[model samples]
Target chain A: MKRVPLSPLRAILARQLRLLRAERGWSQERLAAEAGLNRTYLSAVERSEQNISIDNLYRIAQALDVSAARLLTDL
Target chain B: MKRVPLSPLRAILARQLRLLRAERGWSQERLAAEAGLNRTYLSAVERSEQNISIDNLYRIAQALDVSAARLLTDL
Candidate 1:
């Protein structure tokens, strides 16, 4: 299988998500549980190795206690 | 083909995108062109009939002159 390159926007999002999670002092496992997602998948998303679905993003934003817009702002 | 259900967040995004487009007096064709996407695809996205990719969402946000966060805010 061929690997697709990660889009720059996703790179920014991955970085931003990491910062937000760190700011909240939450581990990847904790955040994934709160967001009702698999920890491994969340790890891939944070590493910009996934094309995260919008629904998953929404759930993660809700778990992070921020509006989705705020989560992706400037990214 | 079987249809996938539209997520609530995507429904909100569709409504917001329509409102924003209307406010700007731009047609789907125009927005699609500006966002560098297919008009048909954009139409489906606006109708909440497609699971829009985050990359395309980012492009559309750029064309809308809003942060991706802003676009998904309140959605």
Candidate 2:
């Protein structure tokens, strides 16, 4: 499969997600389970291969106990 | 003018921007200038009418002195 290039926004989001998850010392699987998301989907998002919905973002943010704005501040 | 309905993501972004700005007691104009963005554009983003780029978001986050990950955690 051809790897699609991520847009600047997607790349930023991917980096931010990884950083946030790391800061919390949570593995991807734990974060995904806490956020009520699939591990594979979370992995895809972190890799910038998926376009996630706002609801999903909200769920993830809630799981992380942070505001959505913080997640978006970087783009 | 007909006000277009905001997507869930847009609404979340707008709310977060407003909340963060208020927390710092910075007006839209000051935030815009500090972030190197136009006041009108910042206003539009706060209203959820503008689709901002990742670069712009990074600038805003820098101006606000917050990590990009915090802004995205609530995604």
For candidate 2, the per-residue lDDT at B18 reads: 84
Chain B alone, candidate 1, TM-score of: 0.86
lDDT of 1 by residue, A26-65 (tens): 9999999888888999998888888887888878887898
Query: For residues B20-60, what per-residue lDDT tens digits would candidate 1 score against the true structure?
Result: 89989999988988888889988888887877768778788
lDDT of 2 at B28: 98
- Where does candidate 2 stray beyond 4 Å? A1-6, B1-75
Q: Which ten residues in a row have the lowest lDDT in candidate 2 chain A?
A: A1-10
Per-model TM-score versus the true fold: 0.80, 0.49
What value of lDDT does candidate 2 attain over all alpha carbons?
Answer: 0.70
Best model per TM-score: 1
Model 2 C-alpha lDDT per residue in residues B1-75, reported as the tens digit of each score: 212233455566677778889999999988998887889988988877776655566677777887644554443
